[model samples]
Target chain A: MTALASLTNHQVRLAQRLVGAPTRDNWSFTTEPVQEPAEGGVLVKTLALSLDPAMRGWMNEGKSYIPPVGIGEVMRAGGIGRVVASKNPAFAVGDTVSGGLGVQEYLLIPQDQINRNGLFRIDLRAGSLTQWLNVLGMPGMTGYFGLMDVGQPKPGETVVISGAAGAVGQTVGQIARIKGCRVVGIAGGQAKCDWVVKELGFDACIDYKAGDVKAGLKEHCPKGVDVYFDNVGGEILDAVLARLARGARIIICGAISQYNNTTPVQGPKNYLSLLVNRARMEGIVVFDYADRYPVAVAEMAGYLKDGRMKSREDVVAGGVAAFPEALAKLFTGENFGKLVLQVASE
Target chain B: MTALASLTNHQVRLAQRLVGAPTRDNWSFTTEPVQEPAEGGVLVKTLALSLDPAMRGWMNEGKSYIPPVGIGEVMRAGGIGRVVASKNPAFAVGDTVSGGLGVQEYLLIPQDQINRNGLFRIDLRAGSLTQWLNVLGMPGMTGYFGLMDVGQPKPGETVVISGAAGAVGQTVGQIARIKGCRVVGIAGGQAKCDWVVKELGFDACIDYKAGDVKAGLKEHCPKGVDVYFDNVGGEILDAVLARLARGARIIICGAISQYNNTTPVQGPKNYLSLLVNRARMEGIVVFDYADRYPVAVAEMAGYLKDGRMKSREDVVAGGVAAFPEALAKLFTGENFGKLVLQVASE
Candidate 1:
């Protein structure tokens, strides 16, 4: 219980807004003395932080699904943590939890702001600390609701997912398969593609870095794509739009490819395909499904246990300072799966 | 009864595929001797033809909702006509009809290919022949189904329409107002704007040629747009996307703004707003509602008669020889409303 003067919480703060791909220069590493929780408050030690493609969005200055991280502020993030001290009756010391822990070693959630910070006890019995930050976290919730709600895939329908090796894509592809869909994934590089197909059991995976996604879709989804879970926007989205079957549904989860663009984001030139095919494109933000997170967690936990689903995370060490370099991996397509920064041990 | 001997048919054919905006050089005029209908067939003489923005897409060279107009082929079109000869028990000579008449003086529907041409008898009692080509025709069908089926507008909800003075836009806006929604329109000029707001009963109309559409939307649709029936896409689509309410639905009917573009069609840069708002964008094709056209037509025809809806048409004279110049008026925004070409006087 080092939520006191004895503890120094190291943190990464946004130093400047991004122009394109984020660099270490965009962040400032600092350390601050930790303080004990106030009455009705709880303090948690960050175990791991989720490094996501969406983090790239939070670094920019503009209106988005969530407010951008202000300069000189702690970079916002979500992670698994262990309660080190608690004055709240609801949260006992040593309770494992998941919430917005930021890119820091400790999270001091004030009493009035507990719910706002999304502080909640997470059961490690269903998943490990890192897995809690992966398949059972924000990314998982996004994939679950975005697919099942918007996509509404029918059995025997061909479901295509881009960024197949990434956090959200892995969850979406696996779940679409569980729902009786024929799953095809698109990822950069042959290794990621091979893993998504051979390991994750995707029916096919297109190596976008090596081949034309349009031709790959035509070959893999001969009957045309019934559901498309888009992560990478730009050309990949256009490719899927071209292959959409009549009544197809496209879920707009993230646009990792266009996040770093110095120029305006390339809008899907083939969006007219939506009209031609009588298809739909919809966007989803995971927070809207917060009320039912536990339900999704319960369903996914069963799949994880039965080996019907797999949660793969690429854990990066060096704690909070590693965040800037780690997040850059998302845009470069370097990380193989769910990228998590390990801040502390249980 | 001039189906055989003393009659000649003047026709307009596609001389070349279009690269951008169409010109007279892309069209070739020809004349041929009229031929009688075969067994179980019908022959119709074109009266008034519906000029549409979608015609631009039909002239392109590639896969689309329909096959592209082939080089040297009679240009595809839909128009109101008078049946001159009928061997089918279902049709009679002198019967008023509507179907795919092409850009020609006669539509000769053969046996077993009647339905493929979408040929059907029209009641002059419900509407005039020119009105049939405007509000009761393909554009009307597109607007009705695209707005009601895809937009799903509710009472008091704000519904915005682009290309407000055009064929589909007028139908959508008038119908939206009649259905108890607050209607905002976007058109190119002052006269069209004034007509759309005052004559068509739209709550407001933005003269895009005169002012900023984005600012107009903000002021007019203060509550945000719940349903948007988009005819002119590109930047206008982006403007509406930026002003979308949470859970908004956008009906993608046409992209007249980008139809003649030589460059890649602009994808809405503000499309990410869909994610922020949890909105959906979908496409609609009137042909998909062929079976339901009668239902929509009957309802709209009531609106037309009861004074709840009005159909405005910008009619052009010159028979079939004037199609090239007439259609160009659409892209130039010179046509104030539903543009129609008079192929033959009643």
Candidate 2:
């Protein structure tokens, strides 16, 4: 058990409110003696951490789907871990779990915090620890429901997605392909674009960092975008809005591009296209579909088993202190797939 | 008919393409001898001309629901008239008709242009000539289907509408009230706001020109906006978006405020609220629901007959020569209720 009696916890806490893109100055790294678990509490040893764009939004002080992380508090994160010690009957030693485990070496989930924080056991036989945080986790569930329900992509229809190399975007493109759609992906850099097309089986991938998005969309989607699954909103969102086919469905999953903006978020100026084409733009939060996760997991597991879907995790070798730099990789387009920080080896 | 044998037509023609708002210099007034209707054609004397915000869009060169008005051509408009002469079996000399009669005193609709231009007989017993151009015409049809089909307001829910004093807004607010929704209207001035609430029976009206719209929405719709029928768009659309309830519906009928903007259209900055609240924003064109107009008109007529609804038309006394000046009144917010120019007394 790695001598839990002498364990010391290393944590990254919010030191200052971020103004724009997060820097090292915005965080504080500290070490403290590990506290004993309270009665009925469970202590989890962090194995891996998920680095996401949503973490940027959680750093800002404003109204969002969830509350902002306050200064001096541990930064919130989604991760996989092994229960090292447990005083609760619901959990036991050596049981693997996944939840909002914060960016820390060890997460001591007091009894009262377990339910609200969503701690649950995961089967290692189903997938690797990194895959659970990728395709079988939040990103996977987000793409499954958002594309199938909100996008409603019909067979033979054209589906274009922004941020196609990111975790959610990768899942969305592959799922749309399985649903019999002509999937086009918009990603940064030539490598990411090639990976999405060659590896993920997308029809075409637009390298937005290299050329014009409007021109690329015209060349690839001659029939126009019937469904646009947007993850990186901003000018890209406006560009897609301009090319919407009649009755197009735009699913607003996230706006990673605007998350680090010092100025006001740039809204899509071409939204009037919705009126001209009789289209709709809607938004979705994955947490809203928590009850249906099992159904999506089962379907995705089948796709994985049959080699119809592929999942990739870019695992950065570092402990808990690597969170800030790992998160920066998302905005810089350096992360090629689902980015995960290895807090410790299994 | 008053001296039909010696009838001369006064017409307003587009002299130059408008850059932003239409100035008098952009139009030319001319007089010409009325031409005889061709074989299977119908000649009509204009009774009342409907002045609309959509005229601004038609002046610009672009693809829309209809084609743009060409230079030196008569300005497009919808009006009620008496069929003075006809060669087709579908119409008689005394038949009262409604169609795109243009900004002219007399309209000679040739055979081939009849169906495409929408020449149809209207019952005088159902409404006054001005009322037909207001409550029983395009604006009413827009409000009926847009609010019912797109907005889909449930009883006791809050429905907020922009451009509350305009032709479509007044109808939308009243219909929402009839559907048992708590209706709030946003207009430019106190007088127009008062008329919407006191005359049209809207639950509340916010004078957008006088104060903050966000504060007004908070004061009126404490439960958050369930349906937002956006006619003005721009900042008002953003304000209403910030107050959307879970599963809210935003019906984008028009963007009157942005129609004349010299700058690019301002998209709703708070559109992410749609994601936070799991809401939808959709666009509707009234022309799409042409086949269902009869059902809407019958139901609206019943509301008028029982005194459950009221119709108001701000009739400006002038012929086609006043077309430019009358349209200017709409952008200036100088006209109250549905602005209709009286080409001639009925």
Candidate 3:
């Protein structure tokens, strides 16, 4: 503990703003000696980090829901960590914490940045560290609020989700199913599709890579989709838009499919279907619903305990060095579940 | 009056479903002898018909908000008419009415079809015949509900409207202004642009033909657009989307620009702006608001009488014979304001 300042902390920093998809060369790996926390501050050692599709948007230099990750800065990420040292009475050493820990081996959060970083202790008894980074992390909050608030699924209504095997998609599907809504998933592969249905308890899963999405939607959602949770926006959005029941709700969560395009995103040409059906398309950011996260966390944690819900994380090991490849897997659909970078062993 | 049954009712019927924009060959001129009213029915003489962008959608072969106009059927339309004779106690011979009058000189509403056609007495003392076809008709109902309900503009917020001088656009801008929002309009030509700003009291009007709409919106709406009434879709819709304020509301009314496209409609490429700004995009079909039309009509009628609202109709003469040309003017952006087919003089 006396030699904490001598511990070298490794990090992956943005080398430049991304043009299309981020590559290895887009980031630079560096290391800096750790520093002791000043008065009323905390030092956290990263254990695991959640790699999300939204990170692709953060690499782009533009106005967005949040500020862009600037060049020469450590890439922003949400993760589970342990307090290595604490100078504040509110937190103590060895407490398991969750926060915007960045793609780094360690994070030094000043007293003023405590609230800004959204640092909080995680109850490991409820879920493991990987589970915390999966269904109990930022993605969980996003899917919870986006579906429960924006999607507003009523029991017996049909809810279709794109990227249904991914982080937010998994949570959205399980929650909708729990709410007694018919859950249909759209995933890139048959394995993913099968998993969402056979494992996650989705009513049906459409293998978008192997089959026609429009035809599958028509087959599964005979009455038309009442709530569509769109993660991969583009053709799938149009497909769902064309099959919406009157007064359907579409939750715009993320668009991994369009995030890496060099050209502009292909907007849903069938958007006028919203008019024909008198429907709505709304955007949801998890950060906005931060205040009510405890209520959601408590409810989902119960689901995890009772076996009514499950979570999977495609944990890629190699610490901070694996982040570049880990983030890239999101766009290629290579990662089978929540892509989490395992920064260190628990 | 006894010769009413002998009078020839000049009509325009759909020759075939249109491939893109309707042309002269797409319609056929026909005539039929006017029939006497059956029991519980009324006969109406068409005074003026509203030519709208939604008509283009009605001509296509598919399911829409309303069923497609069948081949060889009279082109469906809404018009201001006068009852020439009536057997129903609900209507008198001299009553002015508004309903789906079709592209014909006279319509004989049978006993069961009166409610289906939406025939209702129109108060001419509130607005003239052309005004009834423009601001007091379907377009007015569309603009009123779309702007007020879907837009939900707050006081001092910025509202950007496309097709500024058109029937729906004019009504939307005036109402947004009346609601104390800063109004900006996107129009086609200089004349229309000048009229929206100088006459209709919009803060600024963008001439899409002469200038860049994105830049114009940036200049006029320094605080960003809070409410957008999209009449002309395509590029103009994208422009307003690019300048959305946080929590903005977009009302999807009509896409006049894409209605006649031989190619697929170009979707708004900047639609992700909805996500970045935490805004919403909702579509409103005026038919959905029919139960509340009387409330909207009464409010807008008061605005017209008090001079807080104004209307302009570019009435094309030669009755139903000029239907094809008048309808074409909408796609070509030739009409100055509301394009109305003047079937006869009241």
Candidate 4:
């Protein structure tokens, strides 16, 4: 394929509305010849696309941090790309960049949408292309702010993380450990639990699928859970709620476990423990901390540089056609870390 | 009565564990005379008592912010009284103050249990005896901080209070209105609705039993609800959840509706709207703002004195015998404002 094909050609559009969980039938891939960029617009060739649990929330028809990806519209995704062509004064051909460029080999987006207050730019050496969408990106920022700002970990405090082996949960436990907290991670299996305690330096790890979570928490958090960073909100969150100490804080970064739920989401049965313990539980979106991204990025990158922080990416290589299956991996817990789609070759 | 008689006074004990909603038979009141006070104890004559919804949660055998009142123990109630006699240097005979002396007419309590921090002297001019148990007491403090600190209302923003015209709800709406918010109230009937809107100056009031709350909200708050100070939980709270503006906040001060629920408390079905609209629903206990009590009391009192803030107390006269019936008023929405029991005559 010519560079022009990579720049302004292949695309995927929402073929139909999803009935329940998304499937391959919901998307349709197509190809078009290169098109010239209009003034104030730049053409981007997507290289890597981030697959987040939030993608499920985005596909459904409802309100969220943003509106759903419309039927017959290019399926929306965040990606790293190269500016293969440009008519915007701020950008030129061949500048590496990132933005919500859709599931397409090429995109011509307006400068303002592309800029978004300078959140996206070309930075090849800042981190790996996949890393930019992982630890140095949304999941990293989610962990840093959700823990440091919302959870407010203090040294010697017990920090518990549900979905402990997943991308955001893994980073949350590590950050809690770095903050001098005694981190306890709750994942779904022995392997995930072992990785959390052995590789992530968590003081304890509970395999929630194998054992009774409430009992596990009782044995592990003898002092009680002071800060609970929750990613999977279901029975595990309920278990954590029961273990909260007086004045504990629960930071809800995401609730992946119940995302594809057909009916209304069910909350922890023991939430009133907040009143009984004089504790606080807050739901957070990472965009709320946008102004503090530079601070988080610098701190997280330092840990990565020093080998104190590690990130794993399950990269699926294909064109835009791989989006649906890769997104499903998050809910199944099949993606051990950040999931990304390699959309095009440089 | 002799000191020995007062010290061994008959105490109301939990007769049996409540299976679901508590009944009068669940409590048994027995009387005995007091014994002599310890070296640093005071003999108190319980003059006024505060019945709080939290007392219901405390009655259940479970862990909470404070411990359960315990089986066969005096039921926990905050009372204002005179130190009829004292052996403690910090208190003198006839000193008027408030203490957690349980639901008894007289008691010999160690000074540390009541006066560990310092004696909280009541200002007779603040209103009257029962007002201390209402407007200038726990419920008052709860309303003040939950709105200002937790709800964080902004001028002209819509503030909707559930259980409006109840103790905490009435104060929250009034305070939010005073803070320049366009206030809306949710209550059980037209009378309460009229009282809140016409007398209390709330922009509008919805009687949950009389109308569709969601439709009423859409009609009243064109801009959407910015602060929902929830005292009543369940469906009313769920209705409010659907109409939240972006960045709206739900301050969970109390859930009186769910306190007696036999099944586990069901979370608001629409809570996912918090993530969608970038809003937050948080649980807050008023005691967390203890350090700011003087600040709240001073402002509320000034409002009370200047005819800006209204303190409506629904007082039922009698001694400890009135406690059970008075507590029921909160659940029935029978009492218009703060529910207080007169434990003794002046």
Candidate 5:
């Protein structure tokens, strides 16, 4: 983490604007000298990278939560790191922190943006450094609030979740179980589905890719789905819409399946059921409830401590170069649970 | 008032089913002699008939709130009448009542069906009989609860309503005003626009036929709309969706513009904004809140008495023969307010 090593930093940059779906060729890895920390900045060596499905939406040339990474800029992502150098009073040398370090070996983060928003004190002993980006990080917070605050899971209510064994999905199912709801997960295959029911204690798991989801869901959820926590939106969403119980609520946490879609996203054809059953379908962004993060984090952490909440980390090794492939795991459903890229040695 | 009109009579039969839209040609205005009331049955002499846009949806060959009016039976509607005779011990002759008496001069209502649901009993002296069918009735209850419960208006928020000068729209805007919100209305013409702003005290009004609604809305509600009480749907909905503030709520009371469409209801093109803004759009059936009607009616009545609320009745003077044309007025927005047919004298 010396000046000499930082000078040879190789960073991945957006080589060309994606006309349609992004391919591996769109990124360029080049070595460049990392500059010294400015008056109110800190130089950090990337230790871990958080690969999120939201990165795809950020790459698209349209309005979203955040703007698209410019053609020659470093790919935007969250990364856990150690402050190798600093000009700020709060962050000193060797302080373990998280920030928007991008797809790079080193980052010069501004002082003002280095607090609770992105950069947080890391506890390596709690689980693993990767777990910070998984169980205790953005995906965990998303699952916690999206289910607890928005899904409003009541005891004995049948809760169905799409992308059930993935990052946010894994935590969502466990949380629902903790709240005394009959949690049913919709995952991809026998292996992942088995893990959800066995490891996560979900009441049932549907291999959405293996059989007819609508029929499978109906068979499992005889009372009908009271809360549908949707992540992967498409035909699966349409299937869930059909089986919604009276006063059901569909929570649109994320739509990973439709994010990389080349064409426009299709509306759920069976939305009229919202009228028939007097149900509601609502979209939510995590940032809207940022103020309540500590409340959600504390509750989720308590479950994590008592073995009530199970955590899964689909960790991809080989540092920042591993980010792009790790992110792709979400769309392809390749990763088993929370997808995170190990950037540097502990 | 005895059994002279015998056999609990005077029913209008639906002679034919509607092929596309129900017109005069699709109906036969024939009457049958009244049938005698069975034990615990109350005979109602129909006074005022409520004509609603939902009647058109009922005529279509699909599932809705109530079954399609049978080809050989009387058309269903909410009506206020005088209970000329009742066999049930709880009811006596000359008790003013309101119930689904079908579109006819006289109806032999079952005491269990009417009395069990508490469908009858009205104090005519408190408000005009027509007002019960307007502001103090279903339309008023719909506008009141649909906005307050679903829309959840906050003080200083801006509310924009489509079909703004119509029965529900006018009431919704007035209620938003009562909640300390700025209100803007959308109607079809200059006259309706003038009535909404000048008479109803809506802060601003937009004539959809006169200018660009999206632009007009931007100019008027500079802060962006928080609650959209939509009665007329389609393009106006799209325009409203584009200008919604963050965390806005859309109350789908009724979609008058798209009711008669032979094709499927197309999803809004700008619906992604809901995800972007983290907003909610909910469809409501007033009957879902039937238990709370008396509470809503009493509050709305208070508003009516205090001069904070006014009911506008577009009374088409005629008997059951005027039913076809009176129903058509809703689709064309020809009826300025609550469209009612004066079926008989009180």
Candidate 6:
């Protein structure tokens, strides 16, 4: 073990429950003396943390896939880290790992907490630390199973994805293209849309911020949408619902647009089109596919190596305190791709 | 035909388009000389007409599964009629047939129109004319296929349905019960709810008009809803959405609640529950299952014969002129079972 240093652990705690879009006041910066790992325990120093739209949902007080982060608790997050010290046989000093380390500088996971918190080793030679938090991480696994298992895209079918420049959407578009499908993406602005089409290789990208998404779909998807991977649900969902072809499959991955609304989320008014078109819309959560992660990761890793799949991580330079403001960038469409906050160098 | 009876054909025609619900003024009554069957044609006298909630959708001028009923044309209707004369080999005199006969005293269907109009012979020995328009007709077919094919209810699961007392709902409730599932229903009034539970053998029925459907679902479906067959969409659909169990299936059969709405239809605000529950919501139109109608009809008919399924028809006593007023009964919930108009007695 390295010599003991005079270091204090910093964490961003939830100060108040959010009513709408989160502000700086919602977080409380706190510091405490770093504690040594007890017997059968591991101490991990977070290198990079993932900021996701689902984090907004975790702030609300309600029943969800996972429990809400309680007041005065460290905010929950998924990140890449390196084990600084370990008293457990499963991990050794300097081993790169990934887990829900929260928005904190150090995580001291006891033996009893390891199973529940999930700590797994990763080979840094295969991908960078940021890549594990992005493509080989939760969002990539989400896009993989959601598009394949739920959307069930086939060759020559037209697949349209909302939130096209976001983490899951970019991965979904590229995967659909690799499977030989016509892909269209709906993103916020021209720059994001251009990046999706030019770099991500999506066949067409609709700039939803510019004008009517319905018209853009009409122009781009002349045959109508066959598979729709919905990440941002709202009017865009309704617009896509209106243009669905017969037997279309809709995969509900997330709903970023409805996350910040103080009012109730708007449902798709044109949902009746599902009846007219004999279509189906189903919801998916990545955690449900945990058992098959190995298969997905192996397939996606092969694609990454061949340059068939590209991952862009918008890594912001900051520690734990920047979490709240960095999270807000997702809602504003400021982040170009997978949003990540660098807590420390690898 | 048989001395060419001295009769003037009485008909109800569309006077104007409906803004909300159809009223008396939306129809125009007229009489004309009944024409004889031309070459390769059939002449039939309308006996009883099926008054359905779908009539409201047909009155609107827009794209749908079928073309809208045009102004100055006889209002479209489905009915069982006796063939008075025929120049086509497919039909014979005195043969009882079912098809889109429209609201009229007489129908002069040309041979070229026979295939498009879908005129088929019905065996009176199997069921009554009212039963042909009720249990053995479109609504029965709608319920059978919608619940079995779309809902795919498994044994030991809990199933919930809206429009419990109406044509489709009643059949759906009974079929789900026969499938060995715990069935719950939602109806407009206390009487309808009581009848659904008592006569239809549903486990419970929620009176949506009396109180909150959400509370009723929470109380009745403690294990949560596994299959929800939605007939009356709107708030009821949203309420059912909230109580869905993991892997729930929501079958969109009809939206009778939103049929008369001049404003936009209220979408299910809690549709995100589909995500949390990993559920699916799909739409079904009965016409799409036309090829398999005989299989569904035979099974449903057997259930009816064995006293496992019951048929109820709320037949109004009047001729073609009563069409407008009889149609409004569906929207107002005045018709307890299958609403039908008696043009002439069988």
DockQ for each candidate? 0.84, 0.80, 0.84, 0.49, 0.43, 0.82
Local lDDT at B94 for model 3: 90
- Which lDDT value does model 5 have at A241? 77
DockQ class, candidate 1: high
Q: After superposition, how far is residue A100 of candidate 6 from its true place, in Å?
A: 1.0
Candidate 6: list runs displaced more than 4 Å.
Answer: A2-6
Give chain A TM for each model in order.
0.98, 0.98, 0.99, 0.93, 0.94, 0.98
Candidate 5: where is the Cα deviation over 4 Å?
Answer: A1-6, A15-19, A25-30, A38-40, A61-63, A87-89, B6-20, B23-30, B59-73, B88-92, B116-118
- How far is B137's C-alpha from truth in model 1 (Å)? 1.1
lDDT of 1: 0.91
CA RMSD of all predictions: 1.5, 1.9, 1.1, 2.9, 3.0, 1.6
Ranking by DockQ: 1, 3, 6, 2, 4, 5
TM-score of 4: 0.92
In model 6, what lDDT does residue B130 have? 87
Instruction: Please write out the lDDT profile of model 6 over residues B1-346, one tens digit for every residue.
Output: 6555677889999989978889999999999888789999998899999999888888989877688999999999999899988998989999999999999988999999998888999988777898888878999999889899989999989999999899998989999999999999999999999898988899999998899899999999999999999988899999999999999999988798999999998888999999999999999888898899888878878888888999889989889888888999999999999998999875
Rank ordering of all candidates by TM-score, starting from the highest = 3, 1, 6, 2, 4, 5
lDDT of 4 by residue, B127-210 (tens): 566667766778888988888887899998999998888888888988998999999999889988999888888889999888
Better of 2 and 3 by TM-score: 3
Each model's lDDT = 0.91, 0.91, 0.91, 0.80, 0.81, 0.91
Candidate 3, residue A261: the lDDT equals: 95
Better of 2 and 6 by DockQ: 6
Q: Write the per-residue lDDT of candidate 5 for residues B1-346, one digit (tens) a residue.
A: 4563654345556777664566887667766777667898887788888998878766666555556777776777888888777787766788878778778888876756875434668877667898899877888888888899989999999999998887788889999999999999999999999988988899999999999999999999898889998887777888898888988998877777677767756446566667677888787888878789888888878888888887788888878878888888888878888888887787
A161-266, model 1: which lDDT tens digit per residue?
9999989999999999899999999999999999998888999999998989989999999999999999988899999998999999999988888888989888
For model 3, the stretches where C-alpha displacement exceeds 4 angstroms are none
Candidate 4, residues A82-118, lDDT tens digits: the string is 8877888778777888678778887777656655624
Instruction: Chain A only: give the TM-score of model 4.
Output: 0.93
Can you list the residue pairs that collide in candidate 2? none
True contacts kept of each: 0.87, 0.78, 0.77, 0.42, 0.39, 0.82
